[model samples]
Target: MTDNPTTERKGHCLCGAVKITAKQAPSHVGTCHCNMCRRWGSGPFMELDCGTDVAIEGEENVTIYPSSDWAERAFCKICGTHLLYRLKGSGEHMVCAGIFGDIDGLEFTSQVFIDEKPAYYSFAEDTKNMTGAELFAMVQAQQESD
Candidate 1:
């Protein structure tokens, strides 16, 4: 396994102004197939599950928008960096791990909401598929456990 504290990573916005740090690597990583994720991310949305080790120090330069009734999306105001998509009620965050330097041994495990994915594109890789309701339920269960 990769060293714990040494595995900490850094990520920055498109223009390199906004930066983020996470000491813990993701427990789960995947591409999201929801319409909002696609529209906001402009493609398959990559989400990293870092349980609160994620921290953004440059909040002044970022803009936040409520993308859904239960979530918020954050981006760099100046460079339009897709920073994070956090579920308000669930307390789960889907961060753009691309900004972070290549994480050694990192892997993409699953894809959620595959049924909602656009017809124009398809993923050849094997992944677990879950509907929106199922995904929401999973998140809710996690929150309750926490």
Candidate 2:
């Protein structure tokens, strides 16, 4: 956490119900091409390597909508702040990178579910494309290592 309170990054969902504060900016950011992400974010939702230390308050007011059997989308019930989308059966939370207050130098490096991405919209930005199978395989491998 930053000692100089002024440097702390702060943000909340569209609704003031779900507020977040981070001491430091995110280390990485990228977009997801998975259909669930598209439907949840209206566009490729940005993900951040936030680790677990990120403090999330007012969780009670957040609405968790299970987008699929394997995932859940979280939004603020009062203000409908699209806060987070968590993968099912995992301890990880994919936070929206765009919400990081005044963050800069973010680069999109990979696009998961590229094969399923809509054809009408093309990604002009450079990023490594990964199929759903490829991503799931990697996730499975990580789970096994844990």
Candidate 3:
């Protein structure tokens, strides 16, 4: 139930066209409520930050969209399943949370683009919620510090 660096997790696209393996358990699991994410998945996009320790088995079947100046959204080209959201600056990969079947011990820690989250739905878990602007500023500050 902890974020263990040595743990490995495996998953595949809906059509099994692309397989993914992460060398470490995610440090964070988060939900994104931005318009782009909502439109992409018909709801808030839940994801696991797999960092740089992820490997793709069928990269040729993956397509990437430059969703923003700082990030790109990737998906399985064949089945149209969302694959990963990647940071352009750091190359960090946030894989779709549902892709990994029967995973345990992952924690839901935060939500981003909170200002855009629809009022019709809410999560009961108390999580750190960050507005789009706040998230961007925090990311920028982190990059600058790095």
Candidate closest to the true structure, highest TM-score: 3
For residues 1-146, write the lDDT of model 1, one tens digit per residue. 23223256778898987888866756456788888888887798886765566788788998989997988989999998898888786566667878777666676568889779889988776667788889889978987899
Candidate 1, residue 38: Cα displacement in angstroms equals 1.1
Task: Give lDDT: candidate 3, residue 15.
Answer: 99
Using TM-score, rank the candidates from best to worst.
3, 1, 2
Question: Candidates 2 and 3: which is better by TM-score?
Answer: 3
lDDT string for model 2 (68-136, tens) is 787777788887767776766763566777666666555666778888888888867776778989989
lDDT values, one for every candidate: 0.78, 0.70, 0.88
The local lDDT score (0 to 100) that residue 40 gets in candidate 3 is 91
TM-score of each: 0.84, 0.79, 0.91
| Candidate 2 structure lDDT | 0.70
